[model samples]
Target: MKRPHLIVDDEIAVQELVGHWAFRAHTTPIQIFNRATDPFLPGVKTHLFRSLEALDGRGFRNPVLVITRWKIEPSDVDRLEALTNLKLTILVTWSGIDDDRVEPVSSAIAVGSLEVLANSASRVKKILYWRPIISGLNDTNDHFASARRLSEFADATVFTGLFYREEIRAYFREAGVPDLYADVARRKILPRDAERRILSHFEGRPIFRKTSCGVAFAHGVPDFNGHFGIREICDICPEAQHEICGRKHHRPDMEVVRSLARVVSLADLDGIEISDRRIEVSGSSEAQRYFMQHALNFQVHDRAQPHRQHRHGRAEIGWE
Candidate 1:
């Protein structure tokens, strides 16, 4: 959370928005939520099911990412399994953080949901989304062991760090939680050593650095985010997936980038540079950038946020 923000859950508005978004979705390889709450909650599952049912009825074949940390019953599996068109992936978030101020819900809930899905949900893909793995918190050897045991029940596992923004810092400060990062960062606050330890702990497990990479691996496809160009990020990627992504990694022609830029209204087409790994552009919104990235299946970078050599989307806090 960047700031104390007010959220209004307008069901009609969201349904209309999803309809319009799906109406406009023509082969954009991925549709991420882009959801306010945990979709599998009792209060929210109806909407989640209804929306996916509608999308499947419309025969949309793109991958639909369902991010949740709540419970998933066998009925939920049954309903989701009935959907035949869309490639549905449920990303179950678990941090293994003990601090109640940071996370009120127990990670055991996620563990139960993952086990349920692993046993019954064959049509749907499940991922143990081990995240917010801050140092001196959930990055211990025991935490890794717990996550490793949990990972056996998942199609794949993706680990990363926190979005320690100003608002979160203030919240933690008032809650008596220790300061996480040196300061607020636009990118996530995952240190290099933390990442290294996680990699070493997992060894050759189906672990990934990026959510897209995990989803891609689960589906037997290349990363829709095109992370293969950033080879450092793929250091822990499974060997088969490395080859899959490598085969699919091709730089887009400049004319193609220009045409898509025009479509997305990226005015500075001249500033768009086709690099070996990522497409660099001067001015573009996140939505616009993601649209182009999915359309081309390549990484798109904005000039405002320069990616460092080893750090993909992380802050420079601990890397120094």
Candidate 2:
């Protein structure tokens, strides 16, 4: 029932999409235009310009998250800075993986982008998105050192795992690339050992377990996802961010929760559960759940799929 309209054509279509979505009071373009190819700039891939051009001047203070490892010039930063209304955060993805087969784009490109965004673009926030740290590939001490050095360039850093799905495994097999993980996972595969190594390496840094944490930290705002409720997830958060989130954290009223549940048209309102950690609802689409979540600035979970304790958004592959 998730009818997401894909706007891939002209500017008019983009404008129409933005116009329709602009009315929402809290629209976090959280995960969008990950690797958009820039039509104007050759050898550059970024949906940043076209998408942001449409979003700019819309008078929306929505948080926009654009994750990319592509080319982003200083000129592009200027264009991004011009957009004064939107709270934009660019997460430059760099894992230091040198394997041409696994990652076609060099890590240097993303490193350069991070540095540029950090040195320039005063208003626009940046996060050193250190991710997809595969074992024996980019998980070396050198990699960590390089990423640690790069972390200083951004407002914050978030280390995450690889999306080693069945399809990805198949592709790797076809390409004669060795299996990245012992088995594929529903979530990104960040093993316990790898996580420990990362934590140890990134000790005493502005790091986060979640992307929203880094994004919110960069923008100096509370986590719209309301992750502070999950104590384990917030354990890695900086004291300043933790305080900021704590100040804004409040258990939402049941009436408001009921209102959100109704917006999703849940046939049984009795099934809705709202704890400090998250709002749990059954029989709702992803779009409906996310709508309520972004609107309430709280975590919303489907009762059918319960998240594990202390391992909020992580894959069970490593923990087990």
Candidate 3:
């Protein structure tokens, strides 16, 4: 059987990574379409386009378009509805408008909340969720709970994150709110909790499970401390999982570790590789010091093999 053709929205780095990994594992050609340039690329079966009209000119079949930034409006869905063989996959951070009419052509999944969608295990072909630790205000618990619920409903869960326990925790700490850990721990299993609520929202649904992490930089910039630089100062609490890190300072040469190996979008990978690592180093200077101190203490008792690492190999990085 031919490998499924994956179409990722404009996220050149993610697209590139997915392309490389897909080709290596499933012989799939991961295509990319920048929504900023062309919003209707999903309707085009062949040839890339810079405008939606140009894309509509081609009759595409079962084409999957991954959206990262551009919002899908009613008009956009109308154009997509015109395509008979197109399949739309929207990878968004939060649920905004509804596109129920375009249900067949488009399906929306949160980057951190795939588990919520996975409850419909039958309808979903594959699931991709990443980011184990969501470091935000207390409200983020809802997001995590939703994701976990979706995972419960998936046929097979493919959970992928940068690092399992340590890195996730570290990321939270660097974000200036380590309390999120305690929050997730407190409400992980509660039905009313965010994770459980997400599952409940789509229970008994037929959906495949696929999860991934380490794409925080694709959408935004990082701080000086290699943490999400964006500030969440609302009463709603922080959904740290969707926050971007390391935009303030662009570190052309830095190394990131990919603990798990999987095919990702090339655009996603490039975003990580090219993001301002220096910002992380700088923004979290104080946090890094504290982390190092804690790491020293943990090292005395922790014994896990270092799994993966990605290096940019440059110095003099800065943070925003």
lDDT of each: 0.84, 0.79, 0.29
Residues 162-220, candidate 2: write the lDDT tens digits.
Answer: 88889999998988899987888887877788878888999999988889889999999
State every prediction's TM-score relative to the real structure. Answer: 0.92, 0.90, 0.29
If both were scored by TM-score, which would come out higher, candidate 1 or candidate 3?
1
Q: How accurate locally is residue 120 in candidate 2, as Cα lDDT from 0 to 100?
A: 89
Candidates ranked, most accurate by TM-score first: 1, 2, 3
Q: What lDDT score goes with residue 261 in model 3?
A: 9
Off by over 4 Å in 2: 1-11, 19-23, 35-47
Model 1 lDDT, residue 47, Cα: 66
Model 1 shows how many backbone clashes?
0
Off by over 4 Å in 3: 1-63, 83-86, 95-175, 179-201, 211-320
Report how far off residue 298 is in candidate 3 (Å): 40
